[model samples]
Target: MIADFDVSSDWHVAAPYGFLRGLRHEQPVFHSPHLGAYVLTRHEDVRAAYGDAKRFSSAGSLTISRSLTQATRDRLGEHGSFLSSFVANVDPPDHTRLRRSVSRAFTPRAVAAMEERFRRLNEDVLDRVEPDGRADFVPGLGHIPSTKLTARFIGVPESDEEFVKSHVKDWFMLFLSPQPADRQLELADSFLEYLAYVDRLVAARAAAPQDDFTSLMTSLIGSELTHREVVELISTILLGGNDTVPNQLGNSVYRLLRENIWPVPADLTQNAVEECMRIDGASLGSFRYAITDIDLHGVTIPAGALCLLSTDSAAHDETVFDDPETFRIDRPNADAHMTLGYGIHFCVGAALARLQLRTALDVLGERLPGLRLAPGQPIAYRKSIVGRGLPALLVEWD
Candidate 1:
């Protein structure tokens, strides 16, 4: 079965566990002809790669240079250079300063201050769904608070939420998702428009300071970061913060309901969330480029080789978590999941994510304890390589 694995196949992208497990067991570090990169499947190897940023550069982690065809590159023109500036893709020294500057907004103290706001936003959204006995959780419950909170956090006007959301996915696809060069060119057009919009937003925030994230970046423009850097960081946040949380929302809730574990105990809400992250996290894994010819597990990855660290597969590695496939809310090492990443690259917005997710579960369970997956509706995940997300989750509460 391992010999039959195909990374680019629609079946694998939509549901990768079978293939990933095969890779981890049969070949922990296996090269995929389709991906033109090595795949690290074991927990130990994947975690080590994330920590060894020096050896594995983050640049080209999302969008490999070879993926950009000549036509696509020509279309991107000067704006093409900004792709490397995304906070997640930059290496070491540059990443350090950028992360520090933005860290103020996501500190535990700052995130704690946001709990009350998060709770209210979650409540407002759930309140609408309570009247109906059944609903699709994706747009109705999952995306509502996430979009609203992220917009408000970043100083994007609520009126423009739909506009921002519309373009964020296309931007994600342009970099993370594999598509034909012609399609990438089309995506680049929308990406440039969105980039320009963020540039305007950054300028506006600089001109009239506000009590939000954009203004905070603007305040540090000349000293710690450049105007263009601020724009890139904001664009990164918008892209990063937008999809993952919404996907996590659907994934967490979907697991609980499917496993018949609803009405999670108040004391175990955090544990429940962590277990979800371990087993059914939103993101599959991130990409990195090996800086030197390296050997691991009887395989040698050439210098400059691309590696897809399978954090999802790592989470399910039997060596890391005993009986890893089972969904256990009380799992002791659940929080160790690599879904949000590891080491210096760990997600900065983790605090915000936790606050929102915990609030989502608490509010939904308290108000709709009877929640259950609607009968006769099949659950379908998005056809995304990096993100494991449900497009819609039908549920009902009596």
Candidate 2:
């Protein structure tokens, strides 16, 4: 009997590469009833699909919960009103305008200017951890710096950094579905609180100018944006500035420790960072809608069909990288990994993230060369249909 792909199976999330290996070999384009989105597993197909944005429009509900998958459809239903104001939902001319407006802030030069500050902050985080010799790297060291950077970029005062970071972390979990309904409802509360927080920041910035993204937004387009739009955009960047980086750093560190690759060679640090992402990146996949009928490797994806571009699987595609399962920081093609994606929708914060990761590896190697996962502590991953990350990563050093 032939076995069809099951995206929601435990094997897929916990040990996805084994299952993804089968996917790339046999079913490059699969539509699972459980997932509802057409899964593109190979690197070439995924990149091509991403490039053909006209057919694979990103507009619509970007949730990973296959609401059409029976039980989810009945329980959670679908909420389309969520991102009407989100910048990610916009396409073409508007995407062009909004991205251009903020592009100046995330440029390589801009991010470079701010590097020393964050480097010092991350180093300080590790410095404080050195005394303990053992620390929960996730929130202890990871999320803290991201929270500070979020405040720095958003132009908010860091007085309530801890308070806001707590809420932002909660808000970040909203993207992950397939969890209990109770957790979903709780996240709703956190989301509202965060929105209110951003709203207050928006109002405060409009009243008194500050040198930050908030101040920049209030003056854009003759200040024609509604209060609602400003709130939505700020919330969007809050996810960018707070959510992804923390988990990414945690995940990267987790990979290094698990593979016994700590004190990684200096020359291979950059390649190691990319290799970690190639193995298991923070993002599970991104969502796109088939605006028109599309054909893939003998499968027909009907118009309006939801598409899950499995970027994780793409990195594991054997044709793209030799011995894909092996973690080799020396792999020269590590930069080709598509976790940040390609084409017009490539990650805007790539430079900042790379800078942070590069700096983080440097600090870890320098400060605690003997870093290893804490003994006897069970590491846990926060499951999300759209991403993968550790809830806590405890580590110790000699």
Candidate 3:
């Protein structure tokens, strides 16, 4: 049954609720052959599942596509101890410790201080596009600010900025598609290169630290995290911080332009970003392996079962948001949407993402007053079930 759903064309649409809505209504814990796991779709059920991490563990493998080759898994295994350092892969006490190490960096005070830098970065990227009057927003302006900001945040040298940005797409793509062996090896090489770069950054911070995430990480150098754990944590930060924001930024702009709203108002752009995330977030859903059998809505989810919490469905739940299909910027409850997962695994970088989106829109609107999508060109979407965004969004202005 799971395999059947996996191969279905509808799977591409993501919100498979149109097909599985009945199952969710009758049996919220139906087994999906495609995923080879039990899917939890209802908003309430997913919320419950997310809140009770004790019942649904996060320690195991957590991707939907069960087709990942053993080679891919093996490559991931190279991290070994580092793998457990990422907050998403741990449970409870460990997750708490890892999350705290970097929590101060994301506080309201810290993010507010970075607002001007974000604005300046946004303008700098837009300036490059202004002269062309046409540009590929994703790889062009869209990726710049986040890449620059993330590098700066981690205290990585400015010289390595371009090198780091160049690999962001490829690194993200490995999980998005099944690439040729050579391409996979190249990505693995890039991943290790990035790991080494971060390791050096960590060491540099320890030797001569500054007020940055790297410095904060350095403070924990002799604590619970060892040198390898530090490297993994930094790698996780780079991976998480790099791709998602840029994609969200690009996708939000693409969506606004596609809807014929060029030069979207900052407030509206912020709203649109929220809606896009709710509608088609980069992360399709987060995975958790069931630690024990649990019955939900008349269906039994067995122990060791992989349970998926559908963020897309939860966002569109009619009970939660009225007229879930219609994309309205003025929707009152738009802020309540959960593109970021709920409960324990809720995205720690949510504020950073919002800042990027808000800054992007503000700068673009102010600088490119006439920005709009090119009349006849089709916007190309990145091909990935795990995430969604535009790879190239060509646009022109008056």
Name the candidate that leads on lDDT.
Answer: 1
Using all chains and alpha carbons, the TM-scores for the candidates as numbered come to 0.95, 0.91, 0.90
In the range 112-183, model 1's lDDT, one tens digit per residue, is 888888789888987777898988999888888888888888999988888888888787777766679788
**Pairwise TM-score winner, candidates 1 and 2:** 1
Clashing pairs in 1: none
Candidates arranged by lDDT, highest first: 1, 2, 3
**Cα lDDT over the full model 3:** 0.72
lDDT of 3 at 245: 84
| Deviating ranges (above 4 Å) for candidate 3 | 1-17, 20-27, 62-77, 80-82, 175-182, 266-269
**How does each model score on lDDT?**
0.85, 0.75, 0.72
**Which is the better candidate, 1 or 2, if ranked by lDDT?**
1
Error of 1 at 76 (Å): 2.4
Global local distance difference test of model 2: 0.75
Give the Cα error of residue 139 in candidate 2, in Å: 1.5
Off by over 4 Å in 1: 4-10, 65-69, 180-185
Question: Quick one: RMSD of model 2?
Answer: 3.2
